[model samples]
Target: MKSALYLFLLLLALQVQGQHGSKLNAQQQEQKSPHSPEDQSQAEGENSPHIKTAPSNYDFAFRFYKHVREEVGNSNIFFSPLSISTAFAMLSLGARSNTLDQLHKGLAFNLTELEEQEIHEGFQRVLQLVNDPHREVQLSMGNALFIDDRLKLLQKFLDDVTNFYYSEAISSNFQNSPEAIKEINNYIETKTHSKIAGLLKSLDPETVMVLVNYIFFKGYWEKPFNNLSTRDDDFFLDAKNSVKVKMMHQSKPFNIHRDEKISCWVVEIPYKGNAVALFVLPDEGTMKQVEDALLKETVSNWMHSFTKRKIHLDLPKFSISGSYDVKSLFEKMGVTDVFSDHADLSGMAENALLKVSKAIHKAMVDVSENGTEAAAATVMEAVPMSAEFPPPPFIRFNRPILMIIVDKVTQSILFIGKIVNPAAEED
Candidate 1:
């Protein structure tokens, strides 16, 4: 039997309006509180090894975001950095020499500070944490290696991915591009519960192996907005242009902070479980300032500075997806050797020279009054809210906004992107 490990993240909210009837239960509310004693101890303790690599992952997240932003321009942006990182990490198992070093560096890992073993162990810990069955959220992550039946992979490489990364290896005939593409896409769709489909439009016939990583997350807001409050509003694209969108409204107490340095309002909206969504609304013309300041320390400060306040929040009811051929992007990030003929993937298989030919990534997110539903997949072919006090600030996401979803347990960022226009579907 092929065991299905569902690994993805989604945020879902239902239609409601002008009512507090959908408030979180006691347990959910407790999970929303920041800096809990247990959370603090876990961060300072040895139990949470994934914390060590979080900084690296975040660094990669921001860098990748900048690259994608530059490529897509002002279009709506959404992609799972976690899925991308995980796929590359699994690929690193087969990487050697400069190829391996480039992978580590591109992932923003400091070899001097953390050993290679520690890095893999950290990811292992993260996989365990997110897949915890008892957690209220439905979140899962998985990896798969579809290898050409003609090539023989190293036993050690196979063992490492299975034991450390929870990956499954299946024999594939890449020469049959259509069948291979169909099989891989079907597997990903099933894993993400159909949130992501046709992740690979086509596969290279010369491709000896294709590595894939996927994540599916579904989380409901602790405080859902009432559907009655949703109405048409303008979402400004810039100083000159705007688009009409169905804006969801809610007024309630929320964890909010103002970062004067970046000139943005950071609001933390809790999900019904260990995840939380962060909406960063930059003041007019300061979007670039806030984006440039995206760093581990910057986000940490925002999380620590949050204060409960009642405010009226107006957010767009939007759904967006982003797809990219990350081969060029990875090269720009200094991961060149892996894609070139000078590659050293000898650790993967004996007597065969292997290199990643193409790497693709796709992600989708749906946000409504109910919550959020998001799913993402990566194939290496090779590869908010509100609230108020004193009439509380009426913060409306009527312009470009940044969104970040995080898992409190591991402090791992599940997804991050910008919504320049709610009406745009893809970039």
Candidate 2:
């Protein structure tokens, strides 16, 4: 869900349009409410014209995802779209500059300006990553003050997402006044390719919030099991009863790497796009040591230090979904407000009455012969995390484990998950 006030205001903002870097020609086009957020901004600094994001957008997004990977203990998780978008939006706010400027810092704008070829290549890279055959994955571009430019896709993405969420608040079915909720839900159902947003009904709907959903998957072995080879295998889950699971086996020599702290390998499965799933199996009896050693620096270093090797591989075809409340996440990431009525979305509309209310995210993923598949959706908790607890552990696996799904070109996470029980398919 979105902040009730921001949602309503953005709805009006979309219907009421204007060219980039220009006024809305308040005469006959759109009606203006005196108490509206936009109205207040007009009275205050009407001279300041321009929508701004922040310089730290990319770092914020990447760091947040990194946090999720390292902090969340539950296996098989999908990243939420709405949550990531909101993170960008919030990051933009603290950027102290325009969204593009913030993005420049991330994409190395200063180093290699945005050229037409770069845009084409960037989109191509993104598309290739999303359309990879091995793992089902998705990538979205969003923006702010969307006018044709180098960052149009990014801005449009956010604009599209804003409209998507605003529709939810005005739509979902509720007790006495469900008309608005119904209207919005029906409209959104048709927009997101009928993939998500079943209905817009929740406990609280008047504050800042976000909703996220996703899908993910890593493909089966190039040579699938004959059912005979997939006999009950003893999966070391704790010291208790060893769960029986069908194990997929492979003997192809692939890229394998290991150190005193960690073990990793890449297995390529023949598919439409250059598809491959990389697994990082921590050394036996050192799962805790590996996790404890985690840091953005270490992960970045590991990714940069890749070498191919030949080794037998054993993995399992599996799928999973993961969900989390991002209130605390935002707090940890240093984003407050949007949660409180004090939230100032005055740039979009009037009155300082708006507040971020609730956030919920859910993601789904699957892996099989047909190619890997995944989808994710996130809803921001206009408020903050309800519980005051530290984030839980990520995972502790001794045997083979799934690590991440990457769009080799852009190196973005289309889907990130782990399967503790390949057969169970639990989140």
Tens digit of per-residue lDDT, candidate 1, span 148-255: 877888999999999889988888887788998899888887888877766676655567777778888877676766666678999999999999999987777899
lDDT of candidate 2 over 1-427, digit per residue (tens): 2335212101000010111212222221244334433333334341221111111223344555656766676444455332344333333332222333433343223425344233323333333334333222223322222111111123433443344322121222333345545544444444333444544563343423223222232233333323333334666654554566655444334454455445433333332123345466764455555544544355556556655443344454455556555655555554555555445443432222334454445555544322211110121113354542343222223353555554333334444445555555443
Q: What is the C-alpha lDDT of each candidate?
A: 0.77, 0.38
Q: Assess candidate 1 and give its TM-score to the true structure.
A: 0.87
Instruction: Report the alpha-carbon TM-score of model 2 versus the true structure.
Output: 0.55
lDDT of 1: 0.77
Candidate with best TM-score: 1
lDDT of 2: 0.38
Model 1: CA > 4 A from native? 1-47, 371-389
Worst 10 residues of 1 by lDDT: 374-383
Q: Estimate each model's TM-score.
A: 0.87, 0.55
